[model samples]
Target chain A: MSAVALESVTVHAGGKSIVDGVSLSVQPGEWLSILGPNGAGKTTLLRVLAGTIGFRGEAALRGRRIRRLHRRDVARLVALVPQTPVVPHAMTVAEYVLLGRTPHLSLLAQEGEDDRTIAAAALARLDLEELSGRELGSLSGGELRRAVIARGLAQAAPILLLDEPTAALDIGHQQQVLELVDRLRREEGLTVVAAMHDLTLAAQYGDRIVLVDDGRIVAEGPPAEVLTAERLASLYGAQVRVLFDGTTPVVVPVRT
Target chain B: MTAAREHGLPAVSAPHVGVPWTLVALAVLAGAVLVGLLVGPVPIGIGPIAGSALAHVPFLDAGTQLEAAQEAIVWELRFPRVVLGALVGGMLALSGASYQGVFRNPLADPYLLGVAAGAGFGATLVIAYGPTGVDGFVLPLASFAGGVAAVAAAYLVGRSVGGGRTTATLILAGVTVAAFLTAAQTFVQQQNTESLNEVYTWLLGGLATSGWGDVLTVLPYVAISAAVLLVHRRTLDVLAVGDEEALALGLDVTRVRLLLVGAATLGTAAAVAVSGLIGFVGIVVPHLVRLLVSSSYRVILPLTVVVGAAFLVLADVLARSILSPAELPIGVVTAFVGAPFFALVLRTTRSSA
Candidate 1:
């Protein structure tokens, strides 16, 4: 069975369809990357899979309808790393990471020893153990992103949704974050879906890429097939050169 | 565990940072209750007060060295007043902290969503048109109804204006509803000129007339509200991450918000109905607790309950004793402290941002 499936999913907001009819499926342990320009409904599609927004379409996780599932059940199956998460400034990193355990605990139940151990494991996996006692406000930009990823890891969900996960990171940190996610996906047999803006990184890491524009899929396939120079120029409305580096596609913007 | 340590990851324990804070808060509350019982116009000594309290315990024979009048002052008057102050203070602080969590606004207080105005309008209406010698039930009941109604109206108005999507719209609707209710209350006060003194006294807020009846009347509502707020302390912490993130983390954001708001409103209304319109205890006490303890709502909320209770009982003591005869309004004392602290919070948050 597919890990996540969407049949003609559509989301409307402010009198317009932010995510138009879209249909797709992700296999278990597959890495599916969504690339789009601004306002292309990429993030909205991820939100639909995360079950954080309402959509007018059939969306299912492991054969169960998403809308029919309780929020806690959905959370136990999927975890989302929001692009611009609100970080409570005074919240310590340990406390912030523990929020991921909310789905497992009863409403009034405090975090248990098992939950803390899991959170600590996630923090360690993300190389954030040293920053555990530091407040979120004190972290650098890259550290904050990693902390957010640690939170998602602590959820212990099989399917992960990342929205612009590398937006603010430097090149080294970007590679570190993406490599960490790739390792987790490989080692744990986790399904990975990411909405990314960097085409080169998408080409390098995405096993399959889906290019969207105006809330609809415009192209889909391997990076080499979908990210040609002509297609990138016409779809992105930018002049760019597509280079092949040992079967991997590299996108470089060209001056007008 | 060995593998994790190999990667230099420490096996962190549960972040139980609140044990000491809980003890401190409970100690403060105990001290405040003892002070409330001992210090009064009758000047009862601590030894005698403890002796008087111990004398009432079963299987204990502590000397009851106090006269009947002094005993009555401690038990009949000051005892009920302190208990009422505690209930009102705890409710306001808990509600205030919950409101701040739900709205993610630092300035949010128990009165943010029109409770004060609604209760004021209700009490003013009763005082203006009701019979001169109406029983105590009429006024408090009317005030309760008015407070609940005002919040209901605000909620309805907020929902009508797409408040379901964002808390900003709901807060705006609260401002509008509060303004309208305050105007109506002013009109009633102007019309009933003879009742102005009584209305003024109530508007200023006090626990001066508190008794066993007032204590009993507000106890159940306060208890229910406090229980709900305390249970949702962790949920409030989740809400701090914003609506979309909180929802993604498996919370029913809209439902959680509605339930918490309802709980806070119920407690605030009940407390207001009995204690008049005590201000700042809601804002001041919760913020102080937050400053002193961990910012996590798990810590801030429970600590706020005890600290708020202690703070208000002590403030009420000052209200009644500062002038030594003519009592100052409790609301005035809280505002004096709350307003400056509010400014300090604003400035610090601004600088940090």
Candidate 2:
């Protein structure tokens, strides 16, 4: 069964269609990476799938229309980690992570012991146990990104959406974070949809890749089939050489 | 525990609790109330007054030996005035804290959206054109209506601009409305020079003539609004992250913002209606509480209420006794203290950044 299905979803903003009519579906527990250059509406599509943006067309989760679902219900099924989340300067890492338990709580209910255990476990998984009491503003870029991902993990949703999950990380941290996400997917049967800028990383970790350009899907298939040198040069307007180490294709820009 | 330690698992620290801090705040408020009751122009014996006040609490008789006039001065005038001051102060601080949380701006106050200017205009109109023989209730009712209307207008204007997405736009709308209302108030003051003193006194804010009636008038509105705001304290914590984040977290950010703004504005309107335009209590108290206590609304909101009550009661005492026999406007005292504290906060925040 498909975990998510979008039929001709479109989003308009500022007299322009940011996300044109686009249809796609993700199978249960599959890792789908959305690869596109800047200004390609990747973020907009992710927002639409997360139900945070107003969009026209049908978006369904497990055969249910997304528009009909209460926001709380959608939240219980899906979690989205934004590209650059605003961190409250004075908020502790633990408090921020605990906020993910909001959907499971009643309106006036406070966080209980069970909720605390979940949040703490998420932090521990992210190797943030020592920094749990630290203020968010005091963390480095890598630590902050991990904290945000930890928050998404604490939500315990079946489907996770990540927007530029490793934008500012070094190579080592980048590999660590992606490996962690991939491990979680395998262990928990999580359906992961990620918008990525790193083509090599996307081709490696993504079970399937969807290439988008100008608010439309240009190509959709397995990474090896979709990430061709001609398609990359045409989409990015840059000369690129595709090298393969074993079966994985690595793209590096050709020197003029 | 020993087995887990041996297994090399990370230990979870306990959450930072608020009970001990709350007890400390309660003690401070109790002391402030005691001081407020004892100090006044007409010197009253602390023992007798305290005894008389405590004697009224059923099942406990502290005993009182005081003249009728002394009892009247303590029970009838001073006690009610102090209580009214506490209520107004608490309402203003709570409203300010709610505004700050909703707008995600530290500088947002109860009057940021023009509640004070609108209420002032309303009072000015009553002083200028209302029948000379109008009762005391007329002025408060008019001002409350005016205040509510002004905020409603501000909210509408803000919504019309940017769909209320940007805090800057809402603040701009508030400034425009406040300027227009203040101009209208000035025109009324100029036209009715004879009533200028009355208008000025009301605008400057004082509890000199406070009675049980004034307290009773605003009580229900304050109670309801405060309860509503207290219930949403956790929602405010979620909002601190950002609107989009809050929405993604399953909160209806728009609906929560509207409900909170409505409750805070209504409570603020009621407070300003009774006490005129008390400056700085709203802005100063919440920031102070956040600085001294935790920033979480769960702690900030309740502590703001208690500390605001204590702070204002002390300020009222100073206002009356500063220039003995000739009372200073309570607004003047708050501004005097609040302006310096605000500057200090700005400096500290800037330096830290």
How far out, in Å, is residue A21 in model 2? Answer: 0.9
Best by DockQ: 1
Q: What is the C-alpha lDDT of each candidate?
A: 0.87, 0.85
Tell me chain A's TM-score in each of the predictions.
0.99, 0.98
Model 1, residue B42: what's the lDDT? 74
Residue-by-residue lDDT tens digits, candidate 2, B108-202: 77566787888789878988999885636676667777877787787789879869767777777877888899999999999999989888888
lDDT of 1 by residue, B16-123 (tens): 445677788899999999889987777889988888999999889777988998888988899999999998998999999998888887766756678778988988
Top lDDT hit:
1
DockQ of 1: 0.61
Pairs with backbone N, CA or C atoms under 3 Å apart (clashes), candidate 1: none
TM-score of each: 0.95, 0.95
| lDDT, residue A236, candidate 1 | 85
